[model samples]
Every structure is written in structure tokens, then in C-alpha cells.
Target: MKILACYSIKGGVGKTATAVNLAYWAARSNYRTLLLDLDSQGASSFYFRIKAPAKKNLGKRFLQAYGQLASQIKESDFPHLDVIPAHLSFRNFDILLEDLGKRKNRLRQALKGLKKEYDLIILDCPPTISRLAENIFNAADIVLVPVIPTTLSERTFEQLLQFFKQQDLSRSKLVPFFTMADARKQLHRETAIAMRKRYKNFLQHAIPQSTDVEKMGKYRTPIDLFARNTQANRAYYALWRELEPQLKKA
Candidate 1:
């Protein structure tokens, strides 16, 4: 199965929204998609109306075990979509992974058997660079980074790139896209143009800032379910269309 990680070094960049919406579209397109929420806050899980897995079932020992992991998979309201909800204990992932020694590929190895059941696995990751982040980098086929159109966001993206370079990781695996874009703001517009020009791999579609996206928390569903006609929803659809071929190539 192809794995896509929705991640960012900075929080509040629309990472979880990207993951939830993309997984919905993937399932709509007849792909068996699994949305794995790794963020301790459980935003993605909440969006899907799925409860966090109980603490006992999701601790370090059970996390990488195939049987325990498989048992935790919960079906979403949409067909062909399932989720492995995050637990509060996930906040301790860095320490847990550190205790496992230098096994950067542990997450990948744990997910190997899931390939037979899923066509796509979308990981909603926490905003940090830790041992768990290293595991995600090793596991993901393409790291989908949501970058806000601002100076600080761009700087953080650069930091992520520098980390990849220093760690000898494949920089080509990162595919960045603009999120919370406001065309009216000159800074946002200019940053978008400059970053696109600088990073040749940036996705062409940019998700706009909209109240409809913000309402996902109240609606407890993807934008398509409640605001399919809205720009934010259409933007995600376009982004998914742009990403599907790249995923095939990967």
C-alpha cells in the first residue's frame, strides 16, 4: 500500500484537515483507505467521530504488534474508510520509540502486513521533530507537508528540509502544498509565488482559508460531507486529483 503522511513542523497549519479530507476523497474514489491518527490531541479521530483507542490497547508494546494494531482499526461512517484512532498516550511516543533503540523503520515494519488490506494509508502526524517523527519519515512513501503562506511557516519548512538533508533522508519524498491561503493578503500571495518558484515540487492547488473548513469541528465530518460546494472542499478534491498520479508513480 502507498503511505502518505500529512505532517508539518509547525502546528495549526491544517495538517489534520488535509489528512481527513484526503482520506475521504481516497475512499470515495474506491481506494481502501486507512487514516491513522498519530497526534495525541486526536483531532482527526474527533473529525471522524471515532473515540480514541483505550490506553491499555495502544501503549508502546501494543503499538507495533500486528494483532493489537489490527484489532484497533475502526470503520468510519464512509464506506471503504477506516481509522486507527490516537490515544493520549501517543504524546509519549518519542520516549517510547527512543527506548526501542535505533530502529527508525519500526513503524514501517509494523505496517508491512497491512499492505494486503489497504490501498492507501494516510498518517495524521503531530507537529514535531522527534524519534516518532524519524519513524514516520522512514515509514511514509510521500510526506505531505502543509505549509502556511507566511514567513515563519516558510522558515519551519526550511528547517524540516535541513533536517532531512542532515539525516541523509530522501528530500524527494516531501511534497508541500499551501494551506490557509488568503489571496487578498499581499504577503500570502507573494510567499506563495516565491515558495512555488523555489520548491518545484509544491502542489499546484492551494487550500483557501474558509469558515467551512473551520466548521469541521462542529460538523464532525469532512468538508465534502457538509460543504462540498465550497472552495475549501473543491480545493482538497483538486489537490487529491493532483496527488493521485504522483502516488501511482511512487
Candidate 2:
């Protein structure tokens, strides 16, 4: 199975929104998709109207085992899509990973058993650069980064790249795309153009800043389901289309 991680060092860049929408699109395309909400805040789970798994269901290791993780999978309202809702216990992930000592790839190792059941696994990761982030970087086949068209976001994206370089990680696994871009703003427009020129890996499609996207919270579903004809929905569809071939190759 291919693993796509929706991640950003900086939050509020539409990372969770991207993950929710893309997983919906992937399932719509007939792929067996699993959306894993790693964020303790559980925004992805909340968007799907799913509750966090109880502590008892997680066992003493906090569902660190593959079977425990798989057992936590709950079906979403959408067909072909399932969710592994976030647990409050996930807040201890960094500490747990640190305690494991040499097991830097623990998350990757646990996810292996899930490959048989899912065609694609989309991770809704928290915005933290920690040991859990290292496991995500090691596990993901492609790390789909949502970069907002602003100076601060650009700097954080650069920091992520620097981290990858220093750690000797494969930079090619990172595929960044512009998110919440307002073309009407000269700064946003210029930043998009400049960033695309600087980073050849940026996707061609950019999700526009739209109220329709903001309505996902009110609807508690993907924008595609509630605002299918909107530009934001179309952009996400285009993004999935663009990423599909790369996913297959990966």
C-alpha cells in the first residue's frame, strides 16, 4: 500500500483539510483508503464525526502494536474509506518513541500489516517536529506538504527541507503543493510563482482560499461531498489526479 502523509511543520496551513479531502477522493476512486488521525486534537476524526477510541481498547502499550492499531479502525460514512480515529493517548507518542530507544522506525513497522487491507493510507499528522515526526518521515511513501503562500510558511517549509538534508532522508519523497492561496493578493500570487520556480517538486494545482472549504466544519464532511462544483473541490480532485500516478510508481 502507498502511504501519503499530510504534514507541515507549521499548522493552520490546511494540512488536516487536505488529508480529509484527499482520502475522500481516494476512496471515491475505488481505492480502499484508511485515514489515520495522528493529531491528538482529532480534527480529522471530528470532521468525520468519529470519536476517539477508548483507552481500554488501546491496551497498555497505547495501541502500538499492528493488531491493536488495526482493531481501532472504524468505518467512515463514505464507502471504501475507513478511519483510525485519534486517541488522547496519542499525545504521548513522542515520549513513547523516545522510550523505545533504537526503534526509530516503529510506526513504519506497525503499519506493515495494514498494507493487505488498504490500497492507500493517508496520515493526518500533528504539526510537531518530534520523534513521531521522524517515524512518519520514515514510513510515508510520499509526504504531501501543504504550503501556504506566505513568508512564514515558506521559511517553515525550508526548515523541513533542512531537517531532511541533515538527517540524510530522501527529499524526493516530499511533494509540496500550495494551499489556501488567494490569487487576488499580489503577495500570495508572487509567492506562488516564486516558490514554483524555486521548487520543481511543487504540484501544478493550488487550492484557492474559499468559504466553501471553510464550510467543511459545518457540514462535517469533505468539500467534494458538500461543495462539489466549487473551485476548492475541483482543485483537490485535480490534486488527487496529479498524485495518483506518482503513488502507483511509489
Candidate 3:
């Protein structure tokens, strides 16, 4: 199974939306997909109209064994898609990870049991740099970060790069894409051009600021179902098409 994570040190960068939509595209392509919400706020679960898991202690259960984590999985509305709703207890992940000591691959080790069940696992990660983040970095085959084409976003992305360097992690697997971009804005357009020139690994697709994406809060489902013909929807599909080969190799 290929493990993909939506991760960024800064929140409100459209990471959750990117995760949700891409998982939808994967499942729609007939892949057995699992979207795991690891954020304490449970925005991913909320977006899917799913209630938080009653177990509430994902960290505790994750440490126990794969059985507990497997038991927590729920079926999503879309076909071929499954979800593991977030739990409030996930707030203790930093502490829990710290207590694990030298288990370098704790998350990846626990997830091995799912290899037979899922073709793809999309993790909607919490925004933070901690021990838990280290586990995620070790677990994922690729980390997808949503970067708004702005100075603040670029700074954080650089910080993430610096962190990756310090940890001796491979930066090649990181795919940074522009989100909430508006071509009408000169600053946005210039930033995109500059980023593309500076980072050869950057994705070509960009999700423009769309009214349809904002409406996801009201529909509680991927915008593709409601706005399939829209530009934003097309951009999302283009993104998956580009990543399809990479995912296959993974």
C-alpha cells in the first residue's frame, strides 16, 4: 500500500481540503482508499459528516496494536473509501510519541497490518512539528503540502525544508502545490511563477480560489460531486492525473 500524507507546519493552508479531494479522486478510480484524520480538531471528520470516534484515544489505541486502529475505521459515503475519524485524545500525540522512545517506525510499523486491505492510505495530519510529525515523516512515502502563493507560505515551506534537512529526510518526496490562488492578483501570479522557477519539484496544478470549494462546508462532501464541471474540480483531477504514475511506483 502507498501511504500519502497531507502535512504542513502551518495550518489554514488548504491541507485538509487537498487531502479530502485527492482521496475522493483515488477512491473514484476504484482504489481501496483510507483517509485517516489525525488532527485533534477533527476538521476532516467534520467535512465528511462523520462523528469523532468514541474511543477518543487514537494514540493509546495506535500503541496497543493494529486491531484497535482497524476497529476504529468507518465507511465513507463515497465508494471504495474508508475513514478513521479523529479523536480528541489525539491531542496527546506529542506526549505519546515522546514516551515511545526509540521506536523510529512506530506509525509505519502499526500500519503494516493494513497493507492487505488498502491500495492507498491518505493521512490528514495535524499541523505541528513534534515527535508525532517525525513518525509521520518516517511513515509516508510522499508528503503533500498545500502552499499558498504568498510570502508567509514560502517562509513556512522553507522552514519545513530546513527541518527536513536537519532530520536527514529525503526532500524529493515532498510535493508542494499552490492553493487558493487567484490569477487576477499580480502578487499571486508572480509568486507562482517564482516558485515554479525556484523549485523544480513543484506541482504544475494549482487550485484557484473557488466558490465551490468554500461550499464544501455546507455539503459536507467533495466538491467534485457537486461541481464536477467547474475549473476548481478540473484542477483537482489534473493533479491526480499527474501524481498517478508516482503513486503507482510507490
Q: Please tell me which predicted candidate would have the highest TM-score against the true structure.
A: 1
Q: What's the lDDT of the predicted structure labeled candidate 1?
A: 0.93
Q: Encode model 1's per-residue lDDT on 1-250: one tens digit a residue.
A: 9999999989999999999999999999999999999998999999999998655627485456887778889999999999999888888888888777879998998888799999999999999998889899999999999999999999999999999999999999999999999999999999999999999999999999989989999999999989879999999999999999999998
RMSD for each model, in Å, please?
A: 0.9, 1.3, 1.1
At residue 182, candidate 3 shows an lDDT of 92
Spell out the clash pairs found in candidate 2: none
User: How high is the CA lDDT of each candidate model?
Assistant: 0.93, 0.90, 0.88
- Assess the local accuracy of residue 103 in candidate 2 as a C-alpha lDDT between 0 and 100: 72
Task: Give residue 140's error in model 2 in angstroms.
Answer: 0.2
Q: How many residue pairs clash in each candidate?
A: 0, 0, 0
The candidate that achieves the highest lDDT relative to the unseen native structure? 1
RMSD of 3: 1.1
Q: How does each model score on TM-score?
A: 0.98, 0.97, 0.97
Q: Model 3, stretches more than 4 Å misplaced? A: none
What does candidate 3's lDDT look like per residue over 1-250, in tens digits?
Answer: 9999999999987888888999999999999999999998888888888898565566777765999889888899999999988889998988887787767688898888999999999999999988888889899998988899998999999999999999999998788999999999998999899989998888888899988888888889998988889998899899888887887876
